[model samples]
Target: MTQSRPPLNAPHSTAQSAPGALPGTPLRSPADVLGTGVAFPIGVNPRGQLSMVSGERAVTQAILSLLMTARGQRVMRPEYGCRIHELVFAPGDATTLGLASYYVDEALRAWEPRIEVEQVQAQLDGQDTSRIVVDIRYRLKGNPEPRSLVFPFYRSL
Candidate 1:
């Protein structure tokens, strides 16, 4: 079933709901929490790929929330290497795809924002699960380096 993410701004905050909710928003299955926490890496790896790392679920969900919650206000950092880029994504309304689309639009303004998307390819793998991978090809602003990153999403069962 396709379950909608919890509203970012609800009368009942995810933090006040349950375990993951209380400490963090619900993003993945309880079974996967341990592995996601211990195994996933939430930053750029040595390979330079954007790693969902840890907190993939929460981070992803938060991004969704931000897209829904925030209007058109983008987290733009004219300054490079600004940590405030992290605040770009936060929880918002559950109905808005705005943040998701914003993520694509503001792709370059990320942490060390540098690239802009020229093409996007979204596909699904692992037939048994509701998993999706979005591969984005982008061009760096000041360089010839073309970068691509894959983001994976797993819906709650």
Candidate 2:
């Protein structure tokens, strides 16, 4: 004859809650809660001290970094950057300006998820041939107000 086993004291259903989590509450990842942050690059600020930013500010800095970096410059992620630098050598024309804007738009959409891009305008400076002005208009997530930034790139002739 076999002996009877004791009844289990565990909850009846594990599906009701996550492991180690309270009932009616679900677990969340860091990315889902805290926004992404990146340290300010060297020479970005004159303060000369390390600084980090989050939320809309972080997104803005990240956009500028991405735009400044040329594709293939980042190891192990050649496709992670935009080809904006190539615009420097390109003849300043409507088609070239449009292409630059397109590149910025594609790169932002692929990397930045915190903002909804409204418009990307790129144009060559009328007074300075070496300067290219790029204006990015976007609305940050969870924010109703729209924001914009103007990034100027100076190419060496």
Top lDDT prediction, candidate number:
2
Off by over 4 Å in 2: 1-36, 42-50
- The root-mean-square deviation over C-alpha atoms between each candidate and the true structure, in angstroms, is 22.1, 7.2
lDDT score at residue 96, model 1, on the 0-100 scale: 23
- For model 2, how does the per-residue alpha-carbon lDDT over 11-101 read when each residue is reduced to its tens digit? 4444555577766455554354436565657334367655666655667788888887888999999998887777777887888889888
Q: How accurate is candidate 2 locally (lDDT)?
A: 0.77
Question: Taking the tens digit of each residue's C-alpha lDDT, what string does model 1 give over 1-157?
Answer: 8989777755443334444344554545433542232223346767786654333343333333332333334547233321212333333223222333344445434432333556645444457334444465665444466756565443333
Clash-forming residue pairs, model 2: none
Model 1 residue 103 CA deviation in Å: 5.6
Question: How displaced is residue 117 in candidate 2, in Å?
Answer: 0.7
Q: Relative to the unseen true structure, what is the C-alpha lDDT of residue 149 in candidate 2, on a scale of 0 to 100?
A: 89
- The local distance difference test score of each candidate is 0.42, 0.77
